[model samples]
Target: MSELCRLWHVTVTVAGEEVEPLIVRNALRRLSDQRPFLHSLKYAGGRAEIQYWEEAESLLDASSLALRVWNEHRESAGLPRWEVVGLEVLERTVFLSRGMEYHVIVDLHDVTPLPF
Candidate 1:
């Protein structure tokens, strides 16, 4: 039987040498523009949090991709040369069960840039 893909919510946090806040913000905005599926982005001068959904056959596959997201987009997105400091991957159902307050309901078509 073919493995069925499942949706996994991924949150990746990266941190490195500090840079200007505007530079980080703009890079994140560019990243969001390039990857519209991103649910939300939050950043400071030295760190950032990226949230999105990944469709894969297992948590391992999903987390693997999540781990590479930053480096893969670094050049095109102009993201900082940072190290991924944290990662969280949860099945879609489990993610939602965490309650409304823990997440933001984002309309993919209308993503707004948020400040740190």
Candidate 2:
């Protein structure tokens, strides 16, 4: 039988040696270009948070991919060599149930790197 796929909302936080704010912003922009499916991107000199949705067969699969995102795109996006400091993965139903106050609706057309 084929495994069922589920939608997961993932938030990954990474941190590393400090760099200039502009550099971090530019790097995040590049990441957005490469990963347009990302819902939002926010960054500071030494840290960043990436939010997106992942379709996977299991939570573990989703978490594994989320953990690899930073390292996988580091060179292409010119991202800092950061380590994953936090990770949150919630099922779609659970995420939406958290209510509007906890959600940030992001329009791709209006997307710009946000500072955290």
Stretches of model 1 off by over 4 angstroms after superposition: 1-3, 106-116
For all candidates, the clash counts are: 0, 0
Clashing pairs in 2: none
Estimate, for each residue in 1-116, the C-alpha lDDT of model 1 and write its tens digit.
Answer: 24699988888989999988889888988899888888778888889888888999999999999999899999999999999999999898988888742546555423344465
Question: What residue pairs clash in candidate 1, if any at all?
Answer: none
The lDDT for every candidate, in the order shown, is 0.84, 0.84
Candidate 2 least-lDDT 10 residues: 107-116
